[model samples]
Target: MYTDALRAEWTKLRTSPGALWSVVALAVAIAGLSALAVAPVTCPCATDTTKLTLTGVQLGQAVAAVVAVMLLGGEYGTRMITVTLAALPSRTSMLAAKATLVGGLVAVAGTVGVGGAWVAGQAALGDELGAGAVWRPLVGSVLYLVLIALFGLGVAAITRNSAAAVGVVLGLLYVAPLVTAMVQDDDWQERLQRFGPADAGLAVQATINLDDLAISPWRGLGVLALWTLSALLLGGVLLHRRDA
Candidate 1:
């Protein structure tokens, strides 16, 4: 049953032209932005090269969120979610299948984007590429994109509206960081940076200054995972209890 559910979700995604193009757009946005970021750097020493190379993730995540939100929210918007629930019957299996399929697609696109960014960085940065730099941020960046996609899926499931879901996810990713910067107290600012979804998640990209970061790379990722999982769980509970 689970396997069939997964296959059905995959079929729906592949057949949707918007979903297909969104993945391509995501890859292009990430790689292109990373290349642009690398091109301006005359001195690699002045910046965290790994983070700069993966800078595209900031924009790419927005695209990922849109795709994920549309996966479910589009159905809701069209009132097709009723048909979907009627077909699947089990809300848990259905939601899980959607999450899995969306996560898989985002992971593939992220791999391409992050891998391209690394190759671009290597070409542009040349000898400045640290021996330890490529692997962690490369892998972490991919995971970051995947998590952002799942995060979007969860939020969309809760809101059940494409526009609202997109707005909420974008605010979480972009606005939270700016809000963190506006805090008057340094300690509170640091705390916000450590806990804020975007700031904490992007911490995985820091290869140069581990000690200076408010949260360690893995722990920062953990903070994001908590946020993602909480959203998913809340969505799941509401989905189970509510009428389609």
Candidate 2:
């Protein structure tokens, strides 16, 4: 039954024009922005200039989140969710299948986005970084996109409204950066940057100024992962209890 449910959702995603377009748009937006950010500046003093150049994850994440939210919310908007639940009968399996599909889709798209971003970043630097330094940002950026997709899935599950889901995901992604800017105290600003998902997650790409960083790069990405997982769990619980 679960297997069939998974197959069903996979079929749905594969046939959907929106799903295909979303993946394509996500790759282009993330990779293009990353390239633009990295192309003009060479962080000569930084050993891990790869990370600095690939800083477009800050903006690309919002695009991925929007895609993820639309995946589920589109069904709700079209009144297909009720039919989906009818076919599966178990809301748990339905949601699980959706999440698994969303994760897999994001993982594939993320690889493309991250790889493209890395090449752009490297070319922009006009210097070949050590393999070890280069791969971290490349890999971390992929993980970042996956987490953003998961975060969007969670938000959609919670809201079941496309407009609301988009709003919530965008707000979560963009608002923190703005609020961090508004803080009057330097210390608080730094703290917010260290703790905030965007600032913390981007830390994984940092290859320079380690001592001056509020949070280590990999650890910052971990913080974003934690946020993603927490939201998913909350959405899962709500999904289990909801009437559908």
Q: Give the number of the best model, judged by TM-score.
A: 1
What 10-residue stretch in candidate 1 is worst by lDDT? 127-136
Number of clashing residue pairs, candidate 1: 0
The TM-score values for the models, in the order shown, are 0.97, 0.90
- Candidate 2 yields a Cα-based lDDT of 0.78
Q: TM-score of model 1 relative to the true fold?
A: 0.97
lDDT of 2 by residue, 136-186 (tens): 777888888888788888889888898998888777678877989899999
Task: Report, for every candidate in turn, its global Cα lDDT versus the true structure.
Answer: 0.89, 0.78
User: Model 2 residue 103 lDDT?
Assistant: 78
| Local error of candidate 1 at residue 25 (angstroms) | 0.9
